[model samples]
Target: MEYILGAVGLLLGAVIMYFVGAGQRKKILEGQSQQDQSYKLEAEKVVSDAKLNAEKIIAEAKLTAEKTFSEFKDKQEEFKQEKIRESREKFQRFKDEFKQEKEDELVELKAKREALKEEQAAMKEERASFKADRDEILKLQEAVKIQEQQLEQRNKKLTEEIERARQKQEELEHQHERFTSELEKIASLSQEEARVRLMEDVRGKTENEAMALKREILEAAKEDAAKDARKVVINTIQRMCSEMTIENTVSVFPLDNDNVKGQIIGREGRNIRAIEAATGAELVVDDTPETIVISSFDPIRREIARLSLKRLVTDGRIHPARVEEVVAKTKKELTQQIMEIGKKTVVELDIHNLPSDLVRYVGRMRFRSSYGQNLLKHSIETAHLCATMAAEMGMNKNQIKLAKRAGLLHDIGKVAEEDSELSHALYGMALCEKLGENPIVVNAVGAHHDEIEMNNLISCIVQACDAISGARPGARREILDGYINRIKELEEIAKKNQGVSSAFAMQAGRELRVIVEADKVSDQHADELSFKISQEIQETMQYPGQIKVMVIRETRAVAYAR
Candidate 1:
């Protein structure tokens, strides 16, 4: 029984194992089927989504293509319309121009046709007129031929009468010759000797008459012109005799205080040396209180030094560096001041459009002096004279202004030069040319000093004005010592006279007044004394113009009470 049980158990166990294996295989198959279904569903979803996306992409491409084609079609239509419109406008314009050209050609052709018709008619008329004129000319020629024949007959008759007269004259001449021969024999003098004496007497009378006529004609001509020439010269002199102020080389600068002089001459005189070196001027510190004199052969340097010292003393900042800076600044200011003065002068004279460089050069002349005459002042006086003369002459005002400006600038080059060898005239001309001055001004400047020949009226006028201004009385001066000596000499001459008690030189030594003692000299003697002094002045002194000699005869009685 145990064996049998074991066999059954084993068989049951086998059975159970078989069933379990079968169940597991069935679950495995079911799981594989479910996984296949899931893979199939997932593949279907992917394919559906791919097909939907492809359809959407195709539809969008078609819509975009349609929009692009529509736009291209619209652009083509617009381009066609514009081209047609442009072509139409061009054709219209061409038609209008062609129509206008045709109208013009038609009018011109019509006018030509009318002119041709008129010319044809005129030619026919001319033909007829020419025939008439030719026929008239032929008739006049025939009449002239008849007149010529008549004139020939008259000439023949006149010739015949002349022959008869000539024959009669020959007979008369023969008779006269016989009578003359008889008379000659009776007188016993030949005809040749008588003719010779008659010719000699006629020649002598003709010569005497010719000489007398020549002398009378020459005397009349001389007498006619002399008065006018003298009058012109005298009038010119009288017109130019106006008074002018003389310029002096010395310039004065007032001091702020007397103590400033000590500062100017610093410790060990270093300030003076610095000033002299910087300015190239001689500082004349003399006994004159509250005043300093700047002296130099060069007037420009002297003026510059005077200005610089004045500034330094006024500023009270005296040092070597400050001195140089102030001097430079003062010089610059002076240059500008000169330019301003020059421009002002030109404006006052109505001179226009002067070159900038030439204006500056003219300004430099303010610092220059010629024989104690300020160049600028002399120029102003000369300009006035020129303008007055030019107005009198009815010359152009602009030309007169130019002449005066050139005259004023004639000595501008002296600002840079010291010697007189190279004349300021030539130097000024060169400067003006360099500065692009007017040709007329340059010419006047060059000609004023005789460095060049005068080429125009302005040049001549400028030279004349310079001479008039310079030669005027008290227009210029030399050294003071010389001036004093001249005055003393004149006074001594008047004092040496018998009637003169004292003599005074007046008007800057231009005139002399003599005071005579009344007891010693009578009125008649005073007149004689005046005449004698006038003669003495004229003979002894070389003075310009007429000097007035006044003799004062006064009687005074004085009594002193004690």
Candidate 2:
């Protein structure tokens, strides 16, 4: 029974074990079946996804093919349109060319017809001309016959005249010999003596007439020269205007009160001395109320001192230190002022492109004076004169510019440093040449004063302008006494002549007019007197430019017509 129970238990246990194993195997098989079903479902999903992708790709390819087909159609249409345009253009060209060829053919036919008509007309004209020439030849034959008859008549007259001329010549020779013999007997003089007397008589009568003729010729020449000179001078003067009064080397500083003079003088005169040292000008603090005189040979120095004094007075500072500081500052300012003045003057004159250094020298001319005339003003006046003259002469623009430039720079040498050995003209010339001025301009600058030879009309214009400016009345501001004395001397020189009733020095002693006694001095003698007086003046007097001597001998017959 234990065996059977154990066996039964064992079998039951085995059967239960088998059943648990079968349950486990079934669970495993169910898990495998679940896995297989999952795999199959995944495969189906994959296959469905691939089919969808394939359809999408096919749709995209078909869309691309449709787009390509549309593009090809558009390209084909464009090409057809291009071909159609090309064919139309070719046909139009051919039609135009065919029309032009037909027109050309018609023109050629017309030209051939016109040429045939012209040839026929020319042939008819030739035939008419030949007939006219034949008639002219027959008329010429008749004229030849008449000419032969005229020659025969002229030959007869010529022979008779020749014979008469031969007889007349013989008679004249015989009469000449008889007259010579008769003259020798009556005169009782040799042929040479007779000739001398005859010549002397002719000379005596001719000399006076010759003298008058010479005077007339000289007057005519002088009139021509005077006319030209007057035109140039009048034109120049009309164009250029400058200050009547010229620059001077002395400056008068007006003080606000007398107390200011003392400040300028300083303690122990140290202030005045310091100012002098700084400005190179002489300070004259005279008793003249509200006035301090600044004096210097150099106009620039005097100007600086005047300006510095004015500045110091304006600032109400008066001391040696202040004076010096003010002077230094004033100098710099004045220097720049000078440069500006120069630049302005050039601009006003319409001159340009000068070297900077040359311009500075030109600025220095503002402070420079020549014979009491301000050099800078003189230069500007000269430039105006030159430009006017150049215009009147019809010079081109470049020549006109050169004329003005040369005239303005002509006196630039006067402002050269004190130690320069050359005269102003020569110095200015050298400066211009070194500064690369035009050769013609350089020549004019140096030759204005005759220090060098003139090479152009510009130089002559500059000289004339300078003379006109300097020689004009009231141009030279000199001592009153000296001017009066010189005028008196000039009159005395003119009065020394025997024919003079009265003498006057006109045009600021530049010209002398003499009134002679009509009875005592004849017109011929008047000429002689003028020549003598001019010669005496030249030999005895030292004067600027030339002196004009005029002798007037008027015969006045007074009659009362009341």
Candidate 3:
């Protein structure tokens, strides 16, 4: 019974194990089927997505190819159009060049035709001259026989005249002898003595008449000369009417507002110092409303400073480095402007062939002053005056040009960069000569101030024009103290000379009259003293125009009857 119960339990256990295995297998199969279905749906979705992606990619490729083709076509069309334009331009250029060539050829042909016509006319004239010469020779041949016949008649008349003259000569000799004898009897003197007395009387009377005539002629000539000189001077003065401008050492740089002054001054005044150091000018930024004073003895420096400040303010980048850069650039620009001014001045003056160095010097004259007169204006005035005077004197074109050039360059030495001990006139002369200027121009430059002897008419004209320009009323001015000091200095220069009793400055220091004691200075010594004083003044003093040193040595006899 124990064995049977064990078997039954084993079988029941086996059956239960079988049933559990079958249930688990069925659940595994259902899960596998669900996974397959899920995977199949996922695969179907992936395939559809891939097909859509392929279609999209293919469509994009087609669009790209079509776009590329269109681009290529557009590029090709553009290339064709460009080539066509190039060809058209080339053809037009060729046609124009050909037309120009044809025109040139036609011009050449016309010129040749004209030349041929002229040659033909010359040949015709030569032929006509030949024909006329032939006719003249024939006429001369016919007239030669007529002249021979007339010569025969003249010879016969001359023979008859010779015979008549011999008979008249004898009669005249007898009459002369009888007259001489009668004269000797009346005068009670020998023939020779009476002849001598008559000659002396005639000589005395003729001498008195000639002296009187000479004095009258001299007086008349002097009067006419004075009148003519006055007329010319008056006309010259009237013809020229130039405006006057006064220049000062300081320049006023106007600002838009006072606010700009702060930028110009900068932090700690560094900007101001930089500008001053760079431009060699003083910037006076004071309470002056909307203005900065640029103080400098050199006008160029003032101009540079003014322009540099203007740029800095306009640029709104004020700093030490920027200030230096602007200043340097301003200097360069000013230099170029100076050159342009020089070129323009020369062109306006109608002067040519001036060296670049001389042109630069001429430009510098715009910044310079002489005796308070603007040097450039003075030079221009002098040039015009010189040209006018030369024209008035009937000078040739070359001479007039030379006069103008010399007048313009007369004060170039004042603007020269070199340190010169010589006077401006001499230094200018040297400068011109060094630059291979004309000899007449050099002489005029040197002799304008009488520093050297004038060598030509042009030199004299330059000197005269320079004087006229300077001596014009209101052309120049001087400080009162300076003017007074100049007058006193003129007098002192003359008084210091030996044998000078007293000195007077006249014509606003244009003339110095020195009175010398007659006992101390003779007439010859007076001349020498005048020359000495002039030399001393020339070497020691600087004056506008020229000073006339006149030494007066007159003896006054004092015998008063009481």
Best candidate, lDDT: 3
Worst 10 residues of 2 by lDDT: 238-247
Q: What is the per-residue lDDT of model 3 for residues 120-191, given as tens digits with 9 covering 90 to 100? A: 798699999989976865665455555556545654654455455546555655655665677799978899
Stretches of candidate 1 above 4 Å error?
A: 1-258, 286-288, 417-420, 477-539, 542-562
Instruction: Put down candidate 1 lDDT per residue, 467-513, tens digits, no spaces.
Output: 87775556676456666777888899999988678999886676799
Task: Give per-residue CA lDDT, model 2, range 195-265, as digits (tens).
Answer: 56655665455545556555665576556556555654544443332222212556788887998877878
Report clash pairs, candidate 2. none
**Candidate with maximal TM-score:** 2
Off by over 4 Å in 2: 1-248, 478-528, 531-562
What TM-score, over all chains together, does every model reach?
A: 0.41, 0.47, 0.43
- The per-model lDDT (C-alpha) reads 0.73, 0.77, 0.80
Better of 2 and 3 by lDDT: 3
